[model samples]
Target: MKDHETLGERLAEQGISRRAFLKFCTALASLMALPPERAAAMANALARSQRPSVIWLSFQECTGCTESLTRSYTPTLESLIFDMISLDYHHTLQAASGFAAEKSREDAMKNFYGKYLLVVDGSIPINGGGVYSTIAGRTNLDLLQETAKGAAAIIAVGTCSSFGGIPNARPNPTGAVAVSDIVRDKPIVNISGCPPIPAVITGVLAHYLTFGTLPDLDDLNRPRSYYGTTIHDRCYRRPFYDQGKFAKTFDDEGARNGWCLFELGCKGPTTHNACATTKWNGGTSFPIESGHGCLGCSEPHFWDAGGFYTPLSAPVVNIEAATLGAAIAGAGVAVAMSSLDRNKIRRAQQAHEKLTVKEL
Candidate 1:
């Protein structure tokens, strides 16, 4: 693809219809929670805009983020959108290697200085002079520092890069640190997930390509559009949680009946991500849909949070009894539970008063 060619021209050359392109933009707009009318504007802007150069650097990660983005189920639309970017360097996907590959990266940095997007996956280890991870005899720390200087913005594309992920877990030997920890000067957007949803990654790119600015981010620097709501809030099993029907074991009756997985160690309540709604495998299903609870892989330090099978907190009441009561009286039981708690406090106060009177 010629660097000068607009996305529209490139798509046309590839025989991609404008209607399909518009559809993709509409999907992206919906994903980003943009107005319906904005889809057309986004499509137009993207079609006319120059493909921004992207330098993807992988460090202390499992490459799952790259896998998620490149191996998307909707390979046609998603890959096409991916191709819209002038990816100057990505060791995982690029064919060039050794000096040739290094030269390409250097050339892109020089040519698109202060304009190219820097996409980093994985944490950078700082221990032992950052020797834990290196490429081309240069430490990841050094490479990140060098590359970040001229980047227009940086997209930290996984939990590792965003928040130091598993590499920064307890007793970290590598002293892994997030990209934001090192590159403080540049604008950074954390796409924090074990491997962020493919559409989300692309949607961010689309937003940048269309508006020339990053989307509004949450406190964690994650795009609020995707990370604003907790997974439990959007999970289909939420009704089960509210009703107190929980699966005690993976193969329990409740489990088969699609009860809440909270008891089985789902971290949906505290984990903020779009996985519940966005699903995976081309919107087919996410982990919860397959019977396993959310591992809360999107959040920071998830690996060290607790045992994957351990409940976030032990249930205050027996799941079976609460489920039965809820099933019998619905919201009334909830109200009664609240009243009972107040009654218990009132009894305790009365007992305290009696003891004080006796003492007096």
Candidate 2:
């Protein structure tokens, strides 16, 4: 593959039809919440643009992030767009090894200079002179600083590189820190998740490729398009939650009926991500749909946010007291209120919404 070849040229050479390419761009545009009209413009921009050089660096990670991006059973648009990039240096995917692999990284840095994208996964261990993790002869800290110097922008993939993930969890043995903590001079985008949704990863890359600039980001430096709304807002079980119907146990009747899992430690109410909409496994289903609560893997310090099975906040309404009086007095209320009239139900729903808002 040549660096000067446009993405459309590459796709055409590989026998992918323009219609298929346009369909992919439309889907990507929708995922990014762009206007319908923007899809055609995006397609045109991306078709003529040269593939950007990407250097993916791995530090103290489990490789789950890489697996999430590459393990799709079929060749979807995400994989195709990923392939469109000039991945000049990737430890796991590159054919070179040992000194040759190191040389490739150096060569890319020299050739692309300040025009290459620097992608990082896993936390950087700065403890013990950053000896907990090393590549070739240099520590991750040294390498990140060196590579980040000439990067057009930095993309910290996964919670590990974004928020210091599990390696930076309790006990703090490694003194692990996120990419943002180390490289302050460059523009950084954090795509946070235990292993981010594959589409979200490609969506960010696609936005950059089409616009030649980073997308609008939230306070956490995450793409606001994907992380703008909380999972609870878009969850299918939200109606159940609003009605105060919840599952007490995994095998309970409420659970069997697809009721809300908020009481069972769902962090959807507070955690923000696109899981509820974009879903996983090619939009087949997300964790909440599989009869489980959201793990809130996208939030910072989620591992230390408390037990996964614990509720986000104490039960806002108690299940023992059963009447509008309980709701008015701000006391405990029943989970099921089938006998309530329409007006009473509306008041109860408003009460619940108010309390949940305060908690969030």
Candidate 3:
């Protein structure tokens, strides 16, 4: 691949028409919550921009984040957009290994020093001089410090990299720490999901390519467009929750009726992510839609947030007074509805018995 070629040129070579590229840019603009008018601007910027070098560093992780990105529907615009980036070094994706792989990373750092983007997945262990994980005999801590020094920006790609994930959960034997916990100087964007939404990962990259800066982030350093609201607020079952209908058991009538799963230990009320909206597996359905309550995988310390089946009323933190009041009111309404439903059933049974006696 020619290093000097613009993204537009590269896309043209791949037979991707200009119209398709523009459409892709428009989608990206909408994804980022930018105004419709900015789509053209984004298109122009990306067309002219050079493919920036990206060095991906993996540490103590399951490679699920990598799977999410690569398995994002093939031939889709998002996949194409990812392809446009000059991914210089990725442990899993690159063919080179041993000293050759390390050399590739070093070369990219040297070539694009102070210009490259560093993407990280997985937590760095600090216990025992970072002996928990290493690459080519160098500790993850050493590699991260060395690689991060010259990058223009960093993107922490999953819950592991952003918030230490399961490794940093309670009884964290590895003494795992997030990238932000270690690299304080760089402008880091946290895409915090168990394995984050793939489109979200690409969206962040597109934003940088278009606007030449990181997207505005929330207090947790997460892109506000993706992590601005709690899943419960946007869930389809939200109305059921407000109306006080809840599923007590997975096979109960309430479950069959598609009632809210709040009583079934859904962490959606406290979890801030786009899972309810953006969804997963080509927008098919989320955990709640599949009958399983949210595990709140995006939020920090979720692994240690108590049992996945534990009711939110028991161990959930930061329950506002208004929310508590709403829950109480909803429960009251549910009790009244239940009583009315029972009365109607009894009346129907009584009338049927009367008719049976008359026939006899």
Overall local distance difference test of candidate 3: 0.81
Clashing residue pairs found in predicted model 3:
none
* lDDT for each residue of candidate 3 in 43-102, tens digit (9 for 90 to 100): 889988888888999999999999888756422544443555788789998889998999
What are the per-residue Cα lDDT tens digits for candidate 1 across 290-341?
Answer: 9999887887656766457766652233333444675588668877655543
lDDT of 2 by residue, 1-360 (tens): 566478888887888887887887888788778988898898899998888889999999999998888844333545553555888899988889999999989999999999999999999999999999999979999999999999999999999999999898778799999999999999999999999887787888888899999999876898978976668767899889989899999999999999999999887766668999989888899999999998778877657565578676533332223344656756334432333322332433343344345543
Say which prediction, candidate 2 or candidate 3, comes out ahead on lDDT: 2
TM-scores of all candidate predictions against the true structure: 0.85, 0.85, 0.85
Candidate 3 runs further than 4 Å off: 74-83, 314-360
Model 2 alpha-carbon miss at residue 104, Å: 1.1
The TM-score, computed over Cα atoms with residue i paired to residue i, of candidate 2 is 0.85
Off by over 4 Å in 1: 73-82, 314-360
Cα RMSD, each candidate:
10.1, 9.0, 12.9
Using lDDT, rank the candidates from best to worst: 1, 2, 3
Q: Candidate 1 — what's its lDDT? A: 0.82
